[model samples]
Target: MFNMSGLDLMVIFKLAGIGLGTTLINQLLKKTDAGEWVFYTTTMGIIFGLLIVLQYVLQFFEAVQTMFTF
Candidate 1:
């Protein structure tokens, strides 16, 4: 029993978008020789994406607990 609601789809899309944007920005920074910023950009993107997924993971655990009355 998996939940695949619109909100979940949106979250997945958001993560993908963040990954793509981060890659593009990193490439641009590398081209301009701003190598230091590329790392920070990627780290921030990953952190933000993790936070988003973490919220859903918490919600999923809550749902499971409620379903099984654990």
Candidate 2:
């Protein structure tokens, strides 16, 4: 029951966008001498990305549990 949808592509794009955004901001902050903020920004980015995938991961596990339960 693997049905791919437009949302899957969007999620991938969103993750890619976050990665690019973080890299650019990291470089900009490094150049501007705002090194202290870099850690927070990168951590936030990782958190956001994880959040974006958490739902799907949970759903996948739930589906597996249900499939095997019955």
- Predicted model with the maximum TM-score: 2
Once fitted onto the true fold, the runs of candidate 2 whose alpha carbons sit more than 4 angstroms away are 1-3
lDDT of each: 0.87, 0.86
In candidate 2 the C-alpha lDDT for residue 70 amounts to: 53
Worst 10 residues of 1 by lDDT: 1-10
lDDT of 2 by residue, 1-70 (tens): 3234635688999999999999999999999999999999999999999998887777778768878995
Clash number for every model? 0, 0
What TM-score number comes out for model 1?
0.80
36, model 2: CA deviation in Å? 1.1
